[model samples]
Target: MSEKARMTTHKLFLLPDYEKEGEYLTKMHSVGWKLERVSGFSQHFVKCESENVVYKLDYAANNTNYPEYIKMFADYGWEHCGRVMGFDYFRRNADGLSEEEMEIFSDPQSKLDMMKRVILTRMTPLLIIFFMGILPNMYMIVVNSMNWDRSTLLFLAVLYLGVFALYVSIFIYCIRGFRKLKKKYTE
Candidate 1:
């Protein structure tokens, strides 16, 4: 990465939608943009000389031999790009691989298992916190707001609208992502 790197904020919750994230990164790489790092909600990219770079995301935080695991992928042409919350990002130049050969996992079942692990290990905590804590609090707020005027309710609602939207989006994404994987792998 160069010193004069540029970045943009993306709302792509890579958590259940890793394939979509990978596709987005691949598109960026193909346009001569290489992912440098992900910080906060921004995906930082550096200008690169080459296009047609492939990107992939995998759940690797659960792996005990993470170094060797990354080494294995490195041996297979994928360079370790970065990590965001245990999801490992990888990239490689599309020099010689065919269209079907660009994927990191060999089969859908393995990929499905990986996605499951992500849901259980990562999404579960988020679900617990949101449904158990945040949603109930939001409900109570709404109930309490019934005694107040519309303006007061609206004023207080602003405090958690973003958080509520985030949790809702995450829940939807997790369900859809899991279904997508299950349909492809189980059938």
Candidate 2:
């Protein structure tokens, strides 16, 4: 028998919504790549015949009972594919399943709760770093620019400004995603 083709891809950064990330993996599965493992930003997939597979992601960074947590999903038909960066990846055949049946979250409130968990666990630290570290350093760099060469000052300023821009973009993206979810479900 021929060996299955395998490949690796870098996700680069976490998506604002886990559903979007899951949808991306589901799309890949529909095109014949089955997710096998995940390591940091790298996802490994093995080629297979194209089929309808539903992929779902759940963030459970602070889960104390990890096995029980996974067992709960497995009891409901979700096959745990992998976990990376506190995100658990699961998949199952989507044939003859309704959209709600394919979903891992039971209700709109659960989805909102998951988003809150993500915000607390991931975004909070990012906000802290942006406000406490990057902003302060940028201020210091500006106040002490005279001590450094012109080229060095320019490089530091540009670097910090780029990071600042990135942080702002991410914050906006996440807020919009959360608001959309809340409005779509609550309305």
Candidate 3:
């Protein structure tokens, strides 16, 4: 806790992976840095004076009960850090805490429901854009191949194909993340 706060570069994940996010936060806490705030792709960390802090991230939608929801976690000893893209970040001091005591969600069913909310609220719109916008443009580029000259065609092809690849990657990521949560819970 020498300095106030510092910004460090972190690779942003488009799809939410709650467990992985917690792992990263736990790692940061282990090294003396704690999560201060999050905005878009940037995560702010501060030099913390405590160790063994466990973080929990959950897909809490932009709803009226958000404040009360946060209050509940606060009641449970989890500090309301901040929200990023409708996801709530919470952390509690795990001094002498066991593995089970570090958790926020008590059961797999609750965790599964949280992941479902993420898919319905966040990933669904991106999936729609991928299918509606990217797919149609891709189809046009492939079908009307001869109409465009080599140079113009090449540029559009590259641009649209890049978009297509990005969309596919995001879609796959969302699906895989959702399924992994589902499998972990149902088993």
Leading candidate by TM-score: 2
Candidate 1 local Cα displacement, residue 125, angstroms = 0.5
Best by lDDT: 2
Off by over 4 Å in 2: none
Model 3 residue pairs with clashes: none
What is candidate 1's local distance difference test score? 0.80
List the candidate numbers ranked by TM-score, top first: 2, 3, 1
Q: Quick one: how many clashes does candidate 3 have?
A: 0
Per-candidate clashes, comma-separated = 0, 0, 0
TM-score, every prediction:
0.78, 0.90, 0.88
Query: After superposition, which runs of candidate 3 have C-alpha atoms over 4 Å from their true positions?
Result: 1-5, 98-100, 142-147
lDDT of 2 by residue, 1-187 (tens): 9998999998765556677778888999999999989888888999989999999998877889999999999998999999877888999999999888799887888877887888888889888988999999999998999899999999999999999999898889888877886787677
Instruction: Assess the local accuracy of residue 100 in candidate 1 as a C-alpha lDDT between 0 and 100.
Output: 64
Better structure of 2 and 3 per TM-score: 2
Kindly report which residue pairs in candidate 1 clash with one another.
none
Cα deviation in Å at residue 51, candidate 1? 2.0
lDDT of 1 by residue, 1-187 (tens): 5476576757556576778788888888777778888765568888776588888888965688888999999898889988888888888878788876688888777887787788889888888888788888788887898698888788768878878887787688778878876787778
Q: For candidate 3, lDDT tens digit of each residue in 1-187?
A: 5558675656575665767877888888888888888777777888866588888887767678777998888898889887888888899999988778788878888887788888888888877877788888889988998898999899998998888787778778878877877888889
